[model samples]
Target chain A: MKALKALSTSVGSKYLVALTGLSLVGFLTAHLAGNLLILLGPEKFNGYGHALISNPLVIPAELGLIGLLLLHIFKALRHVLLGRTARPQAYTRKVWAGAPSRKSWGSTTMLVSGIILLVFLVSHIATLKFGADYPSAEPGVRDLYRLVVEVFHSPGIVAFYVVAMVVIGLHLRHGISSAFQSLGLMTPGWTASILAIGLWLSVILAGGFALIPVWVYLFL
Target chain B: MKVHLKVWRQTGPDATGRLVDYTAENIAPDMSFLEMLDSVNETLIARGEDPIAFDSDCREGICGTCGVMVDGRPHGPDSCTTVCQLHMRRYNDGDTIVIEPWQALAFPLIKDLVVDRGAFDTIIQAGGYTSVNTGGAPDANAILIPKTVADEAMDAAVCIGCGACVAACKNASAALFTSAKITQLSLLPQGQAEASTRVVEMVDAMDAAGFGGCSNEGECEAVCPKGISLKHIATMNREYRKAMFANR
Candidate 1:
């Protein structure tokens, strides 16, 4: 516990945030790629989804993913709260020096948007991954791809998912660069490369995930 | 070039302040911004008006003394340079320039375009130094700091205590300034003996002096005449964390 406290207090906490963020980035990419299987039509996509959830390794991975997400949110909230408490006066003047870096806006507002993302994630999983506790015509006949298409076909749900994907894109943009820096992988030349990679990864994940909803609403 | 200057005027520390407008005619484009101010002062002195009081010592960019909010930007429109080094060429003719002293609770207005930044000195005094004895200067090569470490320390050491970082910060945070000094000393082996003590005392002093906390904004680096990095702030946080646990 003392070690945990020490870890929490040190720059280690930043590492924790960075590592968890990277994990989420990886998860997003994998999730998006799997969802992209929907392009092959419902049978292949639903089979992939069934296989993923039924896999022996997935249960523990799911637990770990949950832990990682919670940890990231917890630490981010703590840091934001600590920073806020440390400075009571809101900025009223334009700073000419010592401005916050022009990194991704998502990274800066991660705490606020992370909460929104968390809510969206819960509702999304409850709707598709874990069926809502309501009686349906087909009870627990978990066809995730169909469920995804169905939910996205609704205008409100499509709008919500689109907004959530934007937030996710933002989160990944900052998180990618920040994660590399926190892990001590940032070199002068490598910094730009790493940031570029992070940007590409974010775009693909966000774009891919977002395309699913848009496709379902328009074409599918 | 002729320019109109709206300068903040406070007679003394206790007096209320107002902006006074003045015009300088036929100013040289190559003249440093301070030189233009000097020309205005010379004309004012000839007229027997108490020449608009301002602080400046080394006309050179170093020494960190010549600071003013020039036209809403610290050290004028130029990026990564001090006011004394800012030349008149950056502005066009007939420009209406607004100048003000550094405004912060910790930095009190002493007079027109001059704020008493003695709070910085006090904050430094609270801890900005290593407990080294005054003797013959140690051989530079004896330290053997890795080139990377030396480079990083030098980067942090470039902070001139100009309070530009504070002025540029929307929150008026001194974290960059404080962290730069803390990192400068804490990096070298010579300063290692007092590292833990130095970080704790300095951070406490900075907080006690009523400066805002850093929000990781990189504005300080942008306007810093020396281009000091905010990585030093991260270093300072690391040092402070170490001190808290190790000292305990």
Candidate 2:
């Protein structure tokens, strides 16, 4: 137990967080790319979704993705809680010096956003992936593509999705650069490139995810 | 130039303290902040009052002996310079400056503008050195360290053990100071043999001394006299993790 606690505080745990986080980001990008196919209308989009879910390799991959997400969030929360416990006086002081340097506002708020994202993910999977209220059977299936479109048609749902995506964007913006630095990849020349890539990835993920709801509500 | 000063005054370590106001005039812009305080002390001595007590020695900024909170900043308004290196030009002629000792549980007030930074020395003594022998120093080229590794180690070694990093931290964390020492030694071959013991002892000492854990606020780097990077903290974290597993 002491070793476990020490592991959470150690630098190796930082790498674990970074690697798991990177995998999650990669999943988000691929998921968003697939979702964007909905813009082509039901036939192309639903068929694409059907094709993906039906693929022989996809079931295990999805399960693996879920495992990665859980592990990433678990480790992140552990680090956050340990960090908080280590310094309980932070919130009371309006000003403090000698706090750890190299921390950013985005990095500090990651756990909050991650929790919010978890809530968003549960609602998302429940409604669309589980086909809870959709008019269809299990094997042959209801058209998940149409269900997604209908969900996005509601302004409230659309707004919630947009807000969630914004949180995700903020999380990625900090998490990406920090992950690389934690893995000992921070060279001066490479730092700018990594940061730029991280920023671009964040913008694309957030913008892409938010676009789905906006497109369905406005045009579809 | 003239400035209004609100300096903390205490008769001794056990005495109560208060902010005392003084007007300093005709201060040269080129004089470092401590030299200005020296001028003020000269006046106080002439008037037969006890002069303000502060810590300083090696006024060139390398000794890490001088530090004060000026206008709520650890080492004045500079980004990465010590109090002894900060020039008066950074302030307006009539500016009111507040100066006080490093405020932390571990750094008790020794007097006005000087706290007992002995806690840091204690932490250092706990594990900040290598056990390598001093018998006939090894050849300079014998080590053959990579340029990158040498440069990084040198960067960590530049830290002067000043508590400016702690004074600047919101949590008063000793992460920067402790990490700098850890990284400096960990990067060399001579220090490798005792690395695991060094990390565990140093970290335990840091905690036992009541220094707060790092919150990653980055203020320490901003006020570090040597511009020590936060990368060293990350490095220390890595070392501590390795030590834990290796020891177990």
Candidate 3:
């Protein structure tokens, strides 16, 4: 019975969302760390990228990361679908009040922001991983370092990336703490602090990602 | 005080509704929000027009019957008070108030501000109870409860099941309303027997009724006439999570 409950489609979707989302947040932290290596110039950045690709567990780990991302998107889209079906007919003169009225502009646009991030991720992997045209520092290795410098040199691409990272920042502001609340990881005493942490973490992560692009574009 | 009003009017369950304009004049400042509505209805009645239908029972705010979105706020502008308890003096002399029903898919409009809240009752019926044998009651002290736990449970117990939480929620989720019942019983010793079953059945019923999932906006607690805390929602999540691991 417990297993069935665990397996039920609707039984624990919210917690599923929270758990998967938190892992995705973890992935973002790791990815950000890897991205910041670009600030050290091509040799270091490409070295890190090459090492990541050459690791023995890379294939399995990559597959696991993909699974996590899929689950996160799946649970999030499920909530969106549920919310839509729950109110088939739109309200005529609807207005927000109390806490509902207190939503940030980013909180209100989570779906759109999330979709933007999804598009950015696919294009990002394609360009940085498979789309690199330059050769490696050592023979027969991919020169991801050259690609990084060249790509950030473009004004349009930098602009796109800057905007996307900020949206990610905004999304995380509400999302991280909200995931905690969903998972019941809150006490009255900790509520404000949890939310505060989410906000600060968002600013840091977004700021970190945004810094890399601008740095590569100008200083590099 | 005289006020301009745009009230929603729907003839029946199947009828499409729109906001109809009316001017209320010579309204006394001491009158309640519902009384102001009565004055407007009176004018329409004098012209042989169908009176605007609204719900009000126990106009003291205890019945959870009188509810409307006054100027886009549920139960009017006064905090922690229902429409019946809201006074006319809160509005300016020539203010235009946009009155609409508590709109949600679960609570469909019957007419005007009166929605069919039968969905709430259905959810309650699904579990919201213990299966203690029906007979002479046991001594109250037989199941001793701590003061703080009892008080917090009572706090959750105050929900009027008014559906204001649903209407106030952006997603139209009934998590607050449903959680109130779950938290109320799940805290009591007598309710421990069926705790697992109750949470599952009630949540299932809530989902089946087409209410949206809770995103913890906290609007329900803010707009609640009873000032029900979001702590109950946390308790509910705890209960639901436990049920997932411990029971079917």
lDDT of 2 at B97: 86
Lowest-sum lDDT 10-residue window in model 1 chain B: B210-219
Tens digits of lDDT, candidate 1, A1-220: 1446434642446667878988888888788788889889877876786678668999899999999988988876765665554334232224333243543466567766777888989988887877533332344435666666677779998988989998888877777876766544654557569878988888888888888888889988
DockQ of each: 0.15, 0.17, 0.50
How many pairs of residues in model 3 come into backbone collision? 1
> What CAPRI-style quality would you assign to candidate 3?
medium
RMSD of each: 5.0, 4.8, 1.9
Best by DockQ: 3
Which regions of candidate 3 fall more than 4 Å away from where they truly are? A2-11, A99-102
- lDDT of candidate 3 over B125-223, digit per residue (tens): 999877877789798788899999899789888888778888777777888888899989988887898888788888889888988887766778878
- Give the whole-model CA lDDT for all candidates, comma-separated: 0.76, 0.78, 0.82
Q: Rank the candidates by DockQ, best first.
A: 3, 2, 1
- Give the per-residue lDDT of model 1 (tens digit) for B1-248: 99998888889888877788999988999999889999999999999999988889998988999899886667877777899998889889999888887777778777888877887898799888878789999887876889998888898888888998787665567878888899889888877898877876776677667666554446667878888876677677667657756844
**Candidate 2: segments with Cα more than 4 A from true spot:** A1-5, A10-16, A43-105, A111-132, A136-139, A187-189, B5-26, B38-53, B98-119, B134-152, B169-173, B200-218, B237-248
Displacement of the residue A119 alpha carbon in candidate 2, Å: 4.7
Position A164, candidate 1: lDDT: 92
